[model samples]
Target: MSINYLVLVAYLVVTFLVCGIPFGKIIARARGVDIQKVGSGNIGTTNVAREIGKGAAALTLLLDAGKGALATGLALWFFPAFITGGVSVAPHGDAAGLEGLVTLAAICGHIFSPFLHFHGGKGIAVGVGTLLGFAWPVGLMELAIFLVIAVASKRVSAGSVTVAAILGPVFALIYGPNLGLDLLLELAGLVVVWAHRSNIKKLINGQEKEFSFHKRGDKPEPDDDTIGESK
Candidate 1:
């Protein structure tokens, strides 16, 4: 009925479509198979990288990040900014407690995309983008932590889990208590860690695979396609 209500509803719908439908279609058509059927049975970019080539996986990653950014942007636009005193500020709407509703909607859309029969990615990048949209400081902190872990472990899951753990209290502190953002982060962190449970087991067993981005001793030059195939 009210402008805020209409905008809030539109925001949720748009985020779901952006994070769920488009991402599912991209994974399906880009790789000629639904990502849900691939490694780990999850549609996240990490699984995409393992199943499809790096190129397609990169595309999915970018798209996922874009959806989070788009959702937060829409939420901000809908909430509007008003000048209070000498500074411009976001005026709380009736849905003030729904601060990160757009972020959650986007993440949920990615985690259980309708297009993928309610199965999708583990929500690492989507969460990163959501935090980035909410607060750049916390987002950068999480990003730095992820990069450090990824480099050390060479495991995307390791980095993702670590980042999620770091985000919970970080966002809570930044946004203050009594805000809805902490609840969303807490739930999202749980989901992300739960999704990586298998990876954690593998890590404990020391059987976890590492990403290979190096030249092997037997690898041939780029021009030697014939030899490369045999190698």
Candidate 2:
């Protein structure tokens, strides 16, 4: 293998490590709690906000999203060097294809983090970060969709699944004619949907918990234990 190929391999390894950092765990520890033993036993923003506080949740969101953005940014910064090697793995000049691979890798690393014993967040925040890295327009569109749905429905899962379900078509429409890139995005979407299978069941059964901005003094719901456990 050429030096460029070696560089590509190294880039992917670094991306995984960056994306796998358990920001939720770190933030929870700072708050004197173990995220894994808290609300929903999840390390995502929703659970953090519920079990810890909004400040910590916001910080976790930023850090988790940063992982994906940093991974994609690094790939974009270094991928050009590999392209000069005359490699035909991805179509010539198809930067979107390279971005798609990097995005998928980051998402997978976040969802199945090695640092967390192969458990991690649901990938929504990281997905947004990756999409932003791929193209700011796409990322903004997705974020808008997520916010509107989440706010209107008061259900994070509803917004999350809806966005994941449509990412493939939206991506294809925005950047079409790139079969490899489209397929990678579609596969990533599928993985995200699969990760939310439990949420889907709850949605069907009307047992899914809705997000609340204000803390409630009432007892936690029975389903709280499993609400964000999919991560």
lDDT of each: 0.64, 0.77
TM-score of 1: 0.75
- What digit string (tens of lDDT, one per residue) describes model 1 on residues 1-231? 766567667878778777775463475466466554444555567655665656766777787887787677556654554212332212223333454667678777877677656666778888788767656677788888898999998988789888877666876566555355566667777776775667777788896668642132322112211111100
How high a TM-score does candidate 2 get? 0.89
The runs of at least 3 residues in candidate 1 whose Cα sits more than 4 Å from the true structure, single-residue gaps closed, are: 1-3, 22-28, 31-34, 81-96, 175-179, 213-231
Give the 10-residue window scoring lowest on summed lDDT in candidate 2.
214-223
Report RMSD (Å) for each prediction in the order shown. Answer: 8.0, 3.0
Model 1 scores worst on lDDT over the 10 consecutive residues at 222-231
Candidate 2 per-residue lDDT over residues 51-120, each given as its tens digit: 7777888999999888888777767666766677454333224556677777788888888888987888
Candidate achieving the largest TM-score: 2
How far off is residue 34 in model 2, in Å?
Answer: 1.1
What candidate 2 gets wrong by more than 4 Å, as runs, is 85-95, 213-230
